[model samples]
Target chain A: MQENRSIPVMDVLIAVLLIAAGVASAMSARHLGKSVLEPIGPGAFPLAGSFLLIALSLLVIWRAVRVGTTKSNVDEFKPRPGMAVLALALTCAYFLVMQLEWLSFRWATVGYVTLLTAALFDWQPRKLPAAIVSGLIMGLGLTYAFTQVLYVDLPS
Target chain B: MEFLLPAIANVFTPMPFLMMLLGTTIGIVVGAIPGLSGGMVIALTLPLTFFMESTHALILMVSMYVGSTSGGLISATLMRMPGTPAALMTILDGFPMAKRGQPGRALGFGIMASFAGGMVSWLFLALLSPPLAEIAVRFGPYEIFSMTLVALMLISAVSAGSMIKGLLSGFLGILVSMVGVDPSSGALRLTFGVPDLETGFRLLPVILGMLVMSQVIGDIVNINQPIERVQTSFRSMFMSMNDLRRQWTNILRSSLIGTWIGILPGIGGTTAAIASYTTARNFSKTPEKFGTGTEDGIVAAETANNAAVNGALVPLITLGIPGSVIDVLLLGALIIHNLTPGPLLFQDSPEVAYGIIAGALVANVFMFIFMILGTPIIARLMYVSRAYLIPPIIVFCVIGAFAQGNRLFDVWIMLAFGVLGFLMMKAKIPTGPFVIGYILAPIAETQLRSGLMVYDSSFLPLLTRPVSAAFLVIAVLTLFWPFLMKRRKAPTAPAHLEDE
Candidate 1:
C-alpha cells in the first residue's frame, strides 16, 4: 500500500486557529493609533506580534504540508483523552458548585475530590473507600492550611 | 560582602530556616516523583508565599530550586526513569550501575556530584552577579530593549521542536500579555468589552493553569501506566574519599559547563547535563564504558545539572532576565512581592539579592543533608498513587487561582489556560518561550518605545548605538544559526542554499 502522505490534521487545525487569532488581534489593535509621547503606542507591539504570528502560522502550515504525514508523529498522539476530558469536566463542575455557593469550600472540595478520585480509580469497589478518605483529608487539610495557616479567605 | 552577613543572619533566623527546610523537603519529594516537576510545585506554592515576608518567601523558593535539582538522581538511579529532565543523562550510567547490584553506589556518586556542582556554582553566583549587575545598571533603554529581544530570540531558537513553532508560541504569549490597559498611556486595547479583562489576566492564574493544571490533566490521562519499582538498601549511600579523588577533575569540568549553560538565558540544567555528559565521554580514556555504568558519566550528569540551578540564578538577579523556565517562576515571585528584579533590585533591596546568594549556599547544604538522610523515605513517597495525588493537585490549582484575586473569574481563566497549555503541549510547541515572552513583553515594549521617544522616533539609534546594535545582531544570528548549520551539513545542497 502507498504511504499516507497528508498534512497532519492537528497542525492544520492549529495553523487555522492561529491565523484567526492573529487576524482578530490585528483587527482589534488597528484602531488604537500611536501615542503622543512615544512614536509607537500600545497597539504597535500587539500589531507586530499579530503579524508575526500570522506569518509564522503560515510557515507552520507550509512545513506541515511539505513534511507530509509520518507514522511516528501519528503514533505519538496516542493519548487516552477520555479520562482527561472527564477530569476537566469534573473540575469545571466543581468550580461551578463553589461559585454558586451550593456548599462550603471544605465540603465541596471533599465531594469533588472523592468523585474525581473514584472516577480516576476506574470505580474499583475496593479502591472507593481509599478515594473517599483521600478526598476528606485533602479537602479538609487544604481548607485548614489555606484559611488558618495562610489566612486565605476561602468562600464559605 | 557587607550584605552577606546580614543576609546570612536573616536566613538563619528560626522562621526563615524552617521555611527553607520545609521547602527543600517538599521540593525533593516532588522532584523525585516522575510526573511532578519543580516548576509545578513552585507555581503551586507561590500563592502560599503571599502571606509570608518577601525575604522568607524568596528563601523558601530558592531553597526549593536547590533541592529539586539535587533530588532527581534517586529515581534515575533506581528505576532507570529520570525523575526530572535534568537527570536524563544520569539514566544511561545510573540505571546500569543499579542493575548490577550497586544502586547505593550510583546514588552516592550522584548525590556527591550534585553537592559538588551546587557548591561550585554557588561560588560563581556569589562572586559574579554583583559585578554583572554593576555593568547592567549602565544599560540605556535601547540597550535594554535589544537585550530583551536577544533573550526572546535565543529562547525560541534553542527551545525544542520547530523554531517556527517556538516563535509562534512566543508571539502568542506577547499578544496575550497585551490584553490589559496600556501601562504608559492608560488606553485599553484588547479587552474585548469584558469587565473582567479590563484589569487583564494575572500572572498567578495563567501560571497555575499552564504549569499545574495541564500536568494534572496529563497525569489523569496516563494514570494507568505501570511503574517498575526498584528495590535497594540505604547502606552504601556515601562515596569514599578515593572515589571523589578519582572523579574530581570530571566533577569540576561538568560543573563549569553546567554553570556556563545555566547563565545563558532560557537554557536550563537538562541542556547542561547533556553537554557535560558529551564532554565527559569525549574526554574519557574509556569512552566505551559510558552507557554501561561509568562513574564518570554519573558524576558529569549530576554535577552539571545541579550547577545549572545556581548558574541560572545569575541572570535572574542581575539582569531581570530568567535563565531557565523555573527562574521565570522566581521572577514572578519577585514581582508578586512587589520587588522589581534586576540591577535596581540590588540597589534598593540589597538584602533580597544577597539573601538569594546566601540562601542558595545554605540550600545546597540543606539539599545535600536532606538527600543523604531522607532518600529511603523519598523513594517511597515517589511512588504515591496518582489517583490521590492528581485530584489534590487540581484542588490546589483551584485554590491558588481563587486565592490570587478572590474571584471565580480567575479560576475560569486558569481553566482556559490549562486547556490552551494542554493543546500547546500536544502540538509540541514549548511552553517555556510562551511564559518568557508573556513576562518580558511589557519590558521589551516599554524600553523600545522609550528609546524611540528619546531618539525623536528616528529608529536610527537602535542601530547606531553600539551596545544595542551588537545585541540586535546577536539576536538575529541566534535565530538563524540553526538554519545556517543545517545548510552547512546538507550533503546535496549548495552552501548558499536557504531552508524553506
Candidate 2:
C-alpha cells in the first residue's frame, strides 16, 4: 500500500488549495461566530474536515512518489457531451414543471415518463407519439393507484 | 436458542411470510437490472408504506433490502455488467468465467454465498443489535462526538485518490449541511433569504439530486456510445459439492470481513465487497486463476456485499447514524412511520425493533429463492439496448427528485448536483465521502459544540473528557495508520481495494 510512486504534480497543487481553503474556513468561522458561532464553532467540523483533507492529500502525493503508477485504471476518466447536457436540461425542465404546477401530478408524471423513456430507449421523433402514449398510461395508472386505491393525494 | 424460536415464529406469520417472498422476488428482478438500484426500489416504495401499518410495511421493505442487494451478482457474474457499483468488483473476476462459458457456476456460487452471508449477518444483527443499543444508551454528547470523529477517520478508507480530496469532500458536505438557520441559534450560515432556506435542504432531494442525477448526466454524455456485448448460457447455475466444500472457509471469512467493515462508520458496501473479494483472492490456492472466472471470487464479492447490507443497518439501528445513503433513506422512511431508531427504540418499541430483525431473516430466505429462481430471467435484461435504457431512467430521476418533498427548486438543485456530481466524478473525487460528510456534519457540529458548552467553552475539557479524547486518539490513529504502514512496508501493503 505504501510505495514511493512519484505523484502527479497536480496532487501537490490540490494539496496547496486544500490548505488555503482550510485557512479561509478557519477565518470565516471566526467572522461568523459573532452572529452564529465562533471560529472552530459552527465551522469546527468543516475546518477539521478541510485540514484532514489537506493532510490526506499530502500523504497521497508522498505515497504516490514512492509507489509510482500504482494502478492501470488511473486514467479511466471519460466524458460524454450532449447526453450530459440533455439530462441536465431535462432535469431543469422537470423542476420548472413542478414550480408552475402547470402540469398536475398526473400530467407531470406522463410528461416525465414519456420524455425519460424516449430518452432512455433512444427513441426518434417519429416514435414520440408511442412514448407519450405509454408515458401517459403509466402516469395515469400510478396516479390512480396512489390517489384512488392507495388514497395518497399527489401535490398540486 | 430458546428465544430464537419465537423470533422465527414472528417472521413466519402468514402475511409476513408472503410479503417476504413477494418482496424478495421483486427485489431480485429490480436489482438485477443494470440501471436500477436498491435505493430506487426503496424510494419508489417509501410512499407505499406510509398508508400501511408499520410492521407489515417494514416486512416488505426489509425483504426487498435483502433480496435486491443479493441479486446484483446475477448481472455482475453473467453479463459482465455490474447491477450496482458494489458488484463492479464481482465482474472483474466474474465475467472471465462467463466468457469461458462457466457463468452458471459463477452465478450459482454468488447466489448461495449471498444467502449465507446475509443469513449469518441477520443472525448477528438479531443477537447483537439489542445489546449494542443497550450500550448506546450510556453514550453522552462526549461519546457521540468521539463516534463522529471515528466516522471521520473512516473517510480515509473510503477516499480513493489523495486523502486530501476525500477529506475535503467530507468537509464540503458538512459545510453544505450547515445551510439552513442554525438549529441552536436562529442565524443562517449559508442559505440566502429564501423561505425554503429556513429548513435548509431536504435529505432525499439532495441525495437524489447528487446520486441519481449525476448518473443521468454521465449517461447523457455518452448517449450515442456503442458498447461491446457479452455472450452467456444459462447453463450450470449450480455449484458442485466439492466446489462448496472448498469455499466454506472463504465464505465465512468474507462474511466476517464484510460485517466488520459494515460496523465501521462510513465505509459502506463498496469497500465491504472489494475487501471481501481481495481477501478471498489473496488467500485462495489458485490465486493465479483469479480474474479469469474463478468461482470463489464471485462468491466472496457477492457474499460480502450482501452481508454488508445487514451490516450497514447495525449503526443505523443502534446509533442513529446511517452507515450508507440507503440507510439514510431508511431513516427517512422510519420517521414517516413514527419509528425513529436510536438507543431508546429498543425500549420504546420492542415489537417494531424485533420485527425488523425477524423480517430481515425472512427477507434473506426469500432472497435465496428469488436469486436462484430469477437469475435466468434477469440475465435477459443484459440484452436490452442501452439506447432503450437511458431516457426513461432520466425521466424517473426527474420525477423521483420532484417527489421527495415536492419543491421544484429542489429539482433544480438535483439537476445542478447531478452535473456537479458528474464533474466531480470526472475529476476523480469520491462521491461517497460527500454523502457521508453530509449526513455526519450536523451530528458532528451538535456534538462538538455541545461538548464545548458542557465544559464551559474550555478546550482543556475536551482533552480531559475520557470519551472524547479516546475517540480523537482512535481517529488520529486510523488516519495516520495508512501513512505509517506505507512508510514501513511501502512495497507490499497489498492493494487498497477489492479484498481478493
Q: TM-score, each model? A: 0.95, 0.83
Highest DockQ: which candidate? 1
Model 2, residue B387: what's the lDDT?
46
lDDT of 2 by residue, B272-344 (tens): 8877876776787887676777778788888898888888788777767666666766766776688755666
DockQ of each: 0.63, 0.30
Task: Give the per-residue lDDT digits (tens) of candidate 1, residues B206-314.
Answer: 8888878877777777776777666787778898989979999999999999999898776689878877987888798998788888899999999999999999999
Lowest summed lDDT across 10 adjacent residues in model 2 chain B is found at B491-500
Weakest ten-residue segment in model 1 chain B by summed lDDT: B491-500
The interface root-mean-square deviation of each model, in the order shown, is 2.2, 5.2
**Chain A TM-score compared with the true chain A, each model in order:** 0.88, 0.54
Task: Count backbone clashes in candidate 1.
Answer: 0
lDDT of 2 by residue, A58-153 (tens): 665575466545434432344457555665566567556767877776777677768766765556787688778777776788678767887764
Q: How many Å off is the CA of B137 in candidate 1?
A: 1.7
lDDT of 2 at B385: 56
